[model samples]
Target chain A: MKRKFLRRVVSGLLVLSVVAAAFTGCGSASASENSSKDSDSASYRTLDEIKESGTINIGVFSDKSPFGYVDENGDYAGYDVYLAEQIGKDLGVKINYVSTEAANRIEYLQTGKVDIILANFTVTEERAQEVDFANPYMNVALGVVSPENAVVTSLDDLKDDDEVIVISGTTAETYLTKNYPNIKLQKYDAYAEAKTAFENGNGVAWANDNTEVIAFANENPGYKVGIASLGEQDTIAPAVTKGNETLLKWLNEELETLGSQQFFHKDYEETLLDTYGADYEETLVVEGTK
Target chain B: MDFNVINEYIPLYKNALLLTLKIGWQGILVSLFIGLIGSAILYFRIKILKTFIGIYIEIFRNTPLLVQLFFIYFALPKIGIVLSAEVCGTLGLGLLGGAYMIETIRSGLESIPVIQRESAASLGLNEMQSLWHVILPQAISVSVPGLLANVIFLLKETSVFSTISLMDLMFTAKDLIGMYAKTIEALFLLVVFYLIMLLPISILGTILERRMRYGQFGD
Candidate 1:
């Protein structure tokens, strides 16, 4: 009788666990449907509504250095963060910074998790179809960095057996996968991991935005941006949710107004000057006057 | 909601599921080997080797698998030893899973009654013979349930290998999400895929546990 009871209990628990897993799976399915419906049905808050609420949600990277990164004091501080603060100040609302990764920027906007994304988001035609990108504030392009001892200067320089390091979900990954199908690529999920992997000689070179690779090469002694441009030049801009015309217009106006004040130049001085030096200040900063 | 999105990515998901299973089984085998070695060292109570095994268990168990993976894949290269991402992931999982396996097998060895050893000695069996011909067989049988349970745990733990870019199930899910932006569909499929892999192992564990219990007390 005891053995029968034990078997019954075991079977019962197994059934219960199976039920729980199915429930969770279905629950998430419904949850996403609800969220999508919520987004479709007047879910977005307007600029005026945000101003009235006295808060604006801004998404920025907490890991990507010199653009958006957490400082030693654990506060988010970077070029993008500096611009976010300026936007918050100008709009007269408290900024609530939401930390985001590269891959989740559009999702964050679509889900209304953040009102704007300032996460070194490069404006691409494909992305523009999903999110409304504001006027460009900075220029960027894909670049490759390798160890000084054996710098990868061009696509041809890479051996057939050599692998290039890329962060998953980045343009560099997409670019290289499309262009250099024959080359092996070692993709990492995070910038820190990719950096470490590159340092460890896991790949012949690391590919990322020129701004990032430049900064990385400048900071790390033995690395250089050998292939300084791998793909078409692009501009980094803040993106608002699709059909957020009011926010998009306001951001454009703000960028134009900030341009007259040379705000991006000042932003460069404050955040990027130490890293990129003065020469790149003119080339990298977008005036946004147009 | 859009089941079509998941249906569309079936091919990608299938490939990723295969990779995940490949890594999961390889990790299990490697960890089992390490576990057997670790348990044997502790079973014999080798003085210096015991300390080293203790340190190995403590370090791998005390730290996170993600950090250990990062160390092997990223940090070790700074000192000159470079390994592929999959190799680093498997090694990390093996080391971590082995730590837990050691304790499980140790308890199994411990549960073998002292009388068995005494009987072996009386039967004129030496230490090696007793361990080889007598103690290990029973102890390993006792350990079967725990070791299988650990294998299941390690199977799930292989998801963490995605961080190092092993193209496992979770990484494929992330890649799908990145491509399609259908977070729920990708995640639900990921959960279902994991269930497909894990449910069988869990059922096996239960059967082994029941069988081992029956063998132990003859209910």
Candidate 2:
């Protein structure tokens, strides 16, 4: 009896070890091959289900501010939180805000960890193929910031070994990799990590949305937006799953009506006004909500 | 699907593997030294020394290792007990490993028959001589297997030391994962690295245990 028990235990342990190895293999494959099967098989919960559940999980950055971030008192308070609240009220459901980083937003949405992603997710052709965008509430472009005196008009100026830091899932990563293949990237999943990594000489410059880079430059001395803009103006949107037609139709119609009145543009002016200030009004502002 | 991802991180994996081995060997060695000293407190039945070992074992075993590592690495600087990351990590690991080791080695020593000590007493061998010549050699041979097992445990425990920015195996893997977005590859490399350290120790323990079970009395 004793021998049998030990044999069972050992066999059980072997099975567990094999299972862990399998999970590790599966996860490794999925990590590198992100977005391959993502577009075709992404699951979408219907608008009615969201309403009946009485709660919508919206993924947003808890470490970022002026969009979504946790305050000193351990409460979630940001422009995105306020917007999410209003959207929740509009839909007559509770809002469950899931703290997310740039890298995990797509995964969180794909895995049904969130009903919508409003985490400053830039609308791009590559991303649009996977998750449907609900028209941009904000327009942005990739930008880089270095020390105040450093002037860089193009990415070619960066040394081959020198790195441009960016949050992992942000457009800056995509833009830099696509446009300037030679530049090394120091990527962090969180904004705070990228900021610290850049400040610690891990990278020569940090790039993100112009608004964020501008904010970084304004807050820190000896830093300026060296590369003020890159690529076309990209839109920031609230993304949902691809095939949820009811939610997709409702979101498009609501956004068009909202765009006509320009509620989001005013919200941006109110929420993002401090980050941009009057000096950045011309280049950074997307006057129309759409 | 590309194996290039694993190939690219080979340097990181190698560095991590070596660091883990370095820390793992040192941790177990320091722990063995401490366990020997600590078990003496329990073995000799010294009234005051027993209390001190009890306190030490309680303090180290009860407190969280992360907190202990933080106390050594960060808090010690305030009190002017500043130590290097390597020193602090090793010391923290030793203290934690010692708590468990003391019990293990002590139990191995205790498993000896009481009549053996009576035989030593009759031979005019004093307490210290008997302990050194008769008890310890047997205790160590029996205890070697358990101590080997804890060496594996200590190696695994070194993962907690990563938070101090020591760039141990897990830390290096995390850095690679951040760069490549291939968490699986990074973790797999770490798993393999850890297994290489542990599997040999485990196999050695099995052999030692079998040898001790049979050869313990010496024909």
Candidate 3:
């Protein structure tokens, strides 16, 4: 009996030590990896390296329509996806589309999970410090959509209890939190959830990119874009890993060249024209920073 | 790595932690109540209610909490059953957890020897008395470990409450990360807060489990 007790205690200590060691090992390994990623672009592939690899991973939203969404045919089809295809063609590499969310766009680039982020990513000074933004390709601003029965026309109209639905990590969330602190915000991690919540009357209005809310209103009747432009106009651009100058320069030059050919115009015509019609083409398309 | 950001977010995390604990405790209580009732119904071999509970267990156990939450918060309103996010969160967690708790407690109840029940009945104890005095203590002793595990799981599952927009710990972390891109700081705070919330429960559970074990074996 004494021997059995000692053996049990000894084995228990061994198991506990093993678990502790495993946890510490994981913590240190991840810490080192994150630190290295922050200081340098060693993990990210260079433009030449990407070309040689013959495949480029481009992050795009798989839910936001007219921008980056999977179509009924189950293929990635949208404005950003169209640009990505053109990029793949110019770079002479096959495109590997990684579906990303609004929040993880920077993380995807920093972690070398994708070569570029074209997920309707709005350029902000804070985000630019973390990820290198290429030249602008489109124009965007915050917009709010609400049910026709109770349209939320202005920011001041939202009372304390009236929650405004916004997707996590989008410009809308930031804008509302900063400018209208009194308005309660209901945030969802995904666009689909936000839309569903809005439709279910969980929130009085849904705030998102003007392009997204506009498209949403066009696609789904009984809702209207009550606030077409809520905050400062921002440009949507491709983002690469910070300090990945080779890819960044290549993207800028590509955008500048693509501008001369009106590439974004064609992309808009193909992907966004049905939703926005012809009038929005000039306002929405940036065409290589010009 | 960034102590400043962590310090700045402490108040936010503190609020988030409270909401998380509130929901976690409420959900656990609900699960216990449901688990006890369902197990009793099964132990007595009640016919129709037993079948109904069996189906409930299978449905909640088979489906993910995220889906159930979406159904409760988003889908149900269409059928004229609207619930607030907090209510939906608690209900979803309780329903999902009750399923697992029932299975855990049922196994414990089944582990009690038939002779124990017969012996209680022969000793002038009624059915309720047999269950209350004789069967439950031994069955609960066996169940302590599994129930504790389920408790921990249900607490962790409260992380999903963020999906329904309940401003739980996970939502605060993700919101901070989204707004500021402070990945390391936000996630570090998230880990600390969750540990703060869960570790005490885990320690207390171990103590209770050890005490119960000592009582059962006298070792």
- Candidate closest to the true structure, highest lDDT: 3
Q: Candidate 3's error at B125, in angstroms? A: 1.3
lDDT of every model, 2 decimals: 0.84, 0.74, 0.87
iRMSD, per candidate, in listed order: 4.3, 6.9, 5.1
Per-residue error (Å), model 3, residue B154 = 0.5
lDDT of 3 by residue, A1-290 (tens): 45554565566556556655655565577678657755343658899999999999999999988789999999999999999999999999999999998878878887799999999999998898888899999998989999988888988867778888998898889888888888888889888888888888888999999988998899888999999998799999999988788899999999999999999899999999999999999989997764
Worst 10 residues of 1 chain B by lDDT: B175-184
lDDT of 1 by residue, A28-51 (tens): 765776567443445467899899
State which docking tier applies to candidate 2: incorrect
lDDT of 3 by residue, B1-219 (tens): 556777899999999999888888888899999999999999999999999999999999999999999899988999999998888988999999899888889999899889999999999999999999888888898999999999999989988887788889998998888888877778777776777677667666766787787767875
Instruction: Please say which candidate is ahead in TM-score: 1 or 2.
Output: 1
Off by over 4 Å in 3: A1-41
Question: What value of lDDT does candidate 2 attain over all alpha carbons?
Answer: 0.74
DockQ values of all predictions: 0.33, 0.17, 0.34
RMSD of each: 4.0, 6.4, 3.7
lDDT of 1 by residue, B47-143 (tens): 9999999999999889998889878876787777878777887788888998998988898889999999999999999988998888887887788
**B1-219, model 2: which lDDT tens digit per residue?**
346887877786787778777877787788888999999889999999899999999999899888898677656666667675678778888889999899999998998888888899999999999999888878877787778778877888888765555667776666554334455667777776776666656655665666675666652
